[model samples]
Target: MKYYNKLLLLACLSGALGACADDEIAAFKTDKPESIVEYEYLNAYDALKTYVDRTANPHFKLGTGVTESDFLSKGLVYSLVCANYDEVTAGNAMKYSSVVGNNGSMNFSTVRDLVKVAKGAGITIYGHTLCWHSQQNNKYLNGIIADKVVESEHPSEPTLDPSVISNGDFEDGTITGWGGWGNSSSRAISAAGQGHNGGHALKITNPTVGSDHYFVQTSYNVAFKSGETYQLSFYVKGASTGTGQVVAQDANYAGDPFLDKSANKDFAITTDWKLVEMKATVTADRTLILLNTGKYEGDLYIDDISLCHVNTGGGGGIVTNEYAVQSDFENGLDNWGGWGNSSTREVVDGGGYNGTKGFKVVNPTATNSWSAQVAYDFASELVAGETYYLKLKIKGSVAGNIGAGFQKKSDYSGRGDFPAMSVTTGWKEILTSVTVSGENADRFLFNVGAYAGTLWMDDIEIYREVKGNTIPLTPEEKADTLTYALENWIKGMMEATEGYVKVWDVVNEPMSDWPDPTQLKSDPNHTDTENFYWQDYLGKDYARVAIKLARKYGGDNQVLFINDYGLEGSGNAKCKGLINMIAYWESDGVTRIDGIGTQMHVTYSLDPVKQQANEAAVISMLELLAHTGKLIKISELDMGIADVSGTNIKTIAVTLEQHKMMAEYYKFIVKKYFEIIPAAQRYGITHWSPADSPDNQNSFWRKGEPIGLWNLDYNRKPAYAGFAEGLSGK
Candidate 1:
């Protein structure tokens, strides 16, 4: 795909052809002056002009290959190959075989229809093998073989001139046999046997005028198992009226007759060909013997022998069997944390954020009743020069004023609070934007108990807005609320980064893993807070709406992304459904989704080897997302060990070394991205937060388990330096 601006080419061509000479030169005539004659010569003048243009501008050229550097500069990673899928592998078809052979005919309409559908989808078609011994058997081959046998048999039959029958006896072993015609008998003997030899030959008898001259007897033996039934059918024709006895026995009989009554049968043959079917049941292991026992025979032809198993079972499994699983986290103590608990705020196996373990503030008399923040601080202290957006899920318990704010330490002595946004109870989600004023405001404090009614909060994300004006929110202020912040963040990032950040996730996991509201209301297993977020702000269109808004703000320069933590591949049903939803977004003229983010948070070592294995598994999951032709980023990566106090100094050293190795692994991933992803689609990697400093009071954070790249004193640690070096190709 060369990016050719066709209009530009036309414009340049039009400008170059503007000038022309009006005078015509006479053919085969020299001008008065040689210089004028040469000037009038078209080739000579054009060659001179070309030389002058080449000398004046050397860079003018046509058609060149795009270099790797040029591709990278244009953000193209050409290393990864696009995936290919055929109809069978796509697993969306209802039938696998087009020919059923139900009525002994082949039809390809079903297969042709499937191919048509696949072609429309831009999917490749793989033609299966033309011949396979296992699927195609002797029945198909027998029809073809019988026709050849019949054709060969007809040409070799005995024929008599009118004088031979009147003058001689065809059966006599004398008279030179109708052309010394015993010679004809000799040739017939050779052709009828298994090999070209004078043994086991066909015998002809009787010669009469206007009657069949002789009888031809030929036999074939085929082995059969005891107690098996075989059906034999063939086409037969004769040159004249003939009575033929088809006999089956174990072996060839010269003078003796077929003793078994069931083994021999007689049939009349006409001049025209007709099909004959013979069915036999063998009591014991025997050989099939076919004998023609007619006294008068002109020439007999046989074709099409077929045999098949009579009592076969029905065809195996149906192709329509489909398997699927759906889960809505209704069981007791499901992986989804119930709402209203401090520890439940973190995301669980179920789709929704666990809010049950966190503080639940419901209808408090005072302004600040239920305010709980995470144990960790922001990666950097918020400065007055920067802007930040506070994103949280809030479910209004009763219609009342709800306020959310972030507090940062001022003057290194105490904390000062700023309001992000306020919302009224309508059972909806409210997003608030808060800007910090004054110096050194880094830490965040969340407050939700003003004018008290119950409110639920989960996934409180505080990110620095790349660009935007953060005006102070007074008591009388009214704005677009959280939706405005999201839009502003998108626009601001585009403006500040100057389109460097081509990818931005519009929204994270918006689906709740909790039980359905209809079921939760009646079932004891269901919890109220579990469905709060879904019941409130989001409804069903949260993901879709957020994506639309983000795209609107991102403009054409940035690629919008809809990110989630867990759904890595097709195996994860939630993830798969989310993918389907993203596809829906794509169908709505939104092609900006460029990637997915998987948060790889390791809280326990499990063991050194196991930890590494788990990390590899995480990478594999992310690779699956990468396979979607979307950029994959490990959004959040933090590791912690349970027993930090028990860990010896050597253990801590080993842990730090392991962390460093992980950093190196991240570097390896970057290189692999360049190798595996196309230069045009390769988006640079980013860590969730810059630091992982543990809180001293948290039990999980104890025992010198170094998680972050920075210490509490705000100094850079080994992991940070290692990461910087790794990214720098050191």
Candidate 2:
């Protein structure tokens, strides 16, 4: 993952230790032989903690992500943790799902236990997460909102009147299925509001006080199957403001409120009403779904509330009326996971065949496989054994293959790689006909993976044939519960500790791999059932919302940080990506991100040339983060000398020479942090592994390798001395 940050490189050349002239290097007193020997104090030993206390803010606690049992068991792990570090973070205990129980309940047993241990040692807990897309109870959070079934429902079986909402169009001259709520008043049937389908519509004359979102809605019972896919479609016109949002509440609306699957379609401004639709698989036998939107205290007319059972034809059949809005990219790339080693340009208008807006993707770097793509979640939308047509208007800088294939977000197997097509400079329709199957057909992927140039793509459409009007599919991420869930989780954590637990990794890994290291990760569509990619729901503004929530819940004095790995990677791609993200968040709106966490999960060898390169990257990465004017911290700092990077690791059986090399590398990085980053920007360092040997393989860094200042047996290694020297560069 090598990337060259031009601005960072320039800063390093002028200063950073690795690039300094011999005379400048000579100025570091600790590097002098006598000073090094003096700090050793004739072999007087100091814990890594002591060094941190002496040099970089003695009160500036060093932190690490640890397990609850390790500290609770009070094994060798606990002793080492207290001895070498002044702060602690639960690797998973403090996270969302781990602490959340049935419904949106809170269960902080592990966190409470860890907090006790930290309290005893005068250590504080660094809250791990309040917002994340993974490891969430997807079923619990997303499924909480169901169609609330009111008693006294007449027919128990499916009826010919397919309209889920009774009197949905208000053609009956009165509101029937419509449910007014929370200050919603002035409900009436408006003749002037005759819909695009030519009928009077239900109008909300006076909106709720804070109804900038979906407040008043239509709630009714639609008989649903436990495992069947369903969809909702309607025509909505914004109030006088020309904006509106359609929201769908869960069956348990009170328990999991504020979920809107059609958040994007909430605000399609036009006087003429347009059709909007969304797809979801029902989990419960029967439930109530609420359809509503918030307007600016004005009137909003609703018409043609209809629901249908969507048939996903993965078995290969004629298709029609697909989720066309998502394919069109008229608004922006929504629910589309964009990833690769290339730059994903903005969604530009006039780029598609229809001259509307289309997603512009470019291979900024001059390399093949400088790849990127936008993948859609077909989840239960595609039926088995159906012949489906995937079409997109595209003009490529180079001719290559683009597939509408099926693959998992993290481990895509490219099962749906269709026949390759060649397109010229002018926009052309690249169409593929594929018979759907139960193989790896989960997502509909549109890719430009290994192309060397730019690709302008838009107006994507999918269909085959339908005898009548095809049912439309627009994927909507009902985010009401998930968003509030994250907020509540953070609020709960803060309440538990009364804000004594001050710092946190508010957002993690908000950066992508190299080539376009300065951008968010675009590959690995996390739209799977197990993995809940937040970007899919919240988009790039995920960090901004997270930062704001932390500030609101944790109080004003909290130190919130954004953490990511590979920050010290070749060319500093990960680090650069984080800096760019922080900038985006701050400018996006009012946000409170305090520090930058460079999870220096690095690999290096005793090889001098390679080692030096690694050293330079570290300095430049730190310097670049410092340039952002935000607190710079080497969060989760660890280095593996293992063959994990194809270079054989110097495991426990390492020689004395190997030990010295390790010490030197540690010393170099710590000193560079202090030297390159100004005092104000220095957020201190956190050594990940206190002692090596518990279970390296499970750790993300070097699995099955030794990478700690203290040996597995708790004996201080040569690296300890090196760390001390670096921390206190006399």
Candidate 3:
């Protein structure tokens, strides 16, 4: 009967309908076969969020971590997230390092765009972080807390022959007086204000460290008389520790070199600028002072080269208009000192009015003019009757006023004041003449504490105004400054988000596991340049300060959480430490914390015993969180499978059985989250990685691991069904 029905339909379709009528066609039916079900069954379910029972867990939020660009494009990832998750936490866009620039300038455009798009999709944003040790503007922060420089009361007299070396300071914006080549080396005059003395410097780049230091040389031709003593001096620094020397060469450097004509005066160069001086009697009439630095395998800088014939008459020469203090900040905060109030200071590059380097001071509040100060000691006391010229290029993030003056170093007694200046956003050259009326004034001071925003100073020079000053911050002072910095950052971020971001990880990964797992991370060695530990500077109260600021700026509706990883392992030592620390932070009774987050980055073990241990740890972690009576969130939850050999299985290596096991593990975790925590304290779970990690070594989180419910191709994996079932309480 089935064959007849098939034949009839085929014959009618072929137009051979002589024996087939409408009634016959109606009777040409055959029974259908049963369907086969496989992995495809997982796709039949709706979006993951649909399975959550809102009535059972009214406040539970289904969240995912996402990249800002992916979500902003409104592409596949965006649609998928919006359809599946109720909230999103940006992977890095909202981080402290991402929002704050190296100049301490806050840029919220990226964050604002993110909020706008997320708002349109009706997805709430959870602020990933407000404070963290890693990925911070360490250069700026460290600069602020760096040791203050106080110039020597009697600075060494100028040794350079001012007239002998033309363009020695590179102020002509070119390497006019210097020449060199070899060892794949190159040279150029650096940008304006990159010099040791506020103008320019010769920058040399050597790709290879050749056998001889002369392989890379910078030479200046100067006439020298035989049997006459001459002093050659220059300020130099290297990008790394390097070796070089100043060699007196014959004018005929083009030919093979000979001994006796060369004076090999070697120097040990470091990252810090050093004044290098060499004195010798010349044997050649036309001497070439060669800076031999070929063995240095990085960039080298030279500024203010001076070669002078030392007269037996007891003087190199008169250096009229010599600077007492000339600072461009290219060598950092050298010769500058500051203290008082909560203001922080640093020498920042390319933040000056002329787009060069400058000294930056961030004052948290305006107070007494002298409360936050930056000063320089004169090499010698100012001439009582001499009129000194002072000049500086200054600007501020906002309009503000600052005071500058000459003062007695011993007591800070006023000697005289330069006309008080008001700073605006645009760079303004401040020029003034001050006559020292008092005999004992030995320092120049700037009262910057009176300003409430960022201020930058460049080319700060006191010509003949001189004779010629890391005050480490006191522990209490360090805390105050850091607290103000924290509040400023938090306030800016909160204002940018416009209160749409209701929740935040106020502090991330604050506790370290080594030395003492319970203690905060502190690296006195500063191994990582990007890391800046606020707790190391602010003490345990760092977290408390962060919470207070978050509440103040984030509005009353904010939900704050202190997030960390490895909370489920190490026998929950990190977890316990965090809870104990939280109790301490709130001991004052005024600081209220909203919740705690455990990052459950787990692995599905093939070994039965290891798997049991994993399950036990998770159960214990949940119980610990439950005991706190605070909202509990699995902030960053993802899983990878381990093979029988205990090695992590990459996505490509995951077998079907292993994949299913991971799925089961996901289900267990989600189920426990709901089963253990009370309904009211449930802050919900976030799938940190929604798709399997890519097979790329550079991937930041669990690279190449099969750590997601979905495959790389967006195909639903068994883990998806497990997660759905867990959410549905099946």
Candidate 2 regions exceeding 4 Å error are 1-44, 53-59, 141-477, 522-530, 642-645, 648-653, 693-701
Please write out the lDDT profile of model 1 over residues 1-730, one tens digit for every residue. 2211234344446545543423342222322445223222221111111221233323211111112232223222111101111112111111112242432344444444544443454433222211111133234322222211111212222211111011111111122211212112211321322211211212333233222211334444445566655555545555677665544455433222232235545565676756666655666666544444335434444432233323221222111111111112233222222222232233224333342332334443434423433222444556564444445544445533433434454433323344333332322233334446556665554444344445454444555532112223321221223334334433443343333333444555433334421110121221332221211222344455555654565455554555454443223444455556666656767455666555444444436665465456555554556567765544444444433343323223544445555555544543444345444344444343233444456424233555554444323344444444434444
Q: What residue runs in model 1 are displaced by over 4 Å at the alpha carbon?
A: 1-503, 511-539, 567-577, 603-609, 641-676, 696-705, 714-718, 721-730
lDDT of 3: 0.79
**What C-alpha RMSD separates each model from the true structure?**
41.3, 21.9, 24.2
Give the higher-lDDT candidate: 1 or 2.
Answer: 2
TM-score of each: 0.28, 0.54, 0.54
The residue-by-residue lDDT of candidate 2 on 1-730, one tens digit each, is: 1122233344446455544558667564423345233223314555556666444464466676576787889886676677667777776787777877767788877777777778887877777766665677776765544322233323223212123443454543566545556454566677843754665776665545453554445456555666666666777765454554443334655311222364344445455676666655555565666554445466666676666555554322323444422467776776666666756766787876768887777755543431466567754545556656666678877544444465544566554444444444656555555556555456766556656567788866666444222232223424554567677877788787666788888887767665577776543443456655666556677777777777888787888898888888788767766777787788845786888888787765766678778888888887788888988778787766743345656464676667677788888888888888887677778877766644444655465566777666555567777787887774
Residue 502 of model 1, lDDT score: 35
What would the TM-score be for candidate 2 when compared with the true structure? 0.54
> Model-by-model lDDT, in order?
0.38, 0.63, 0.79
Clash counts per candidate, in order, are 36, 43, 13
lDDT of 1 at 493: 34
lDDT of 3 by residue, 284-403 (tens): 565677778888898888887767666443222223454668888888887788888878889888886567778998888889988998889876787787767677888788766788
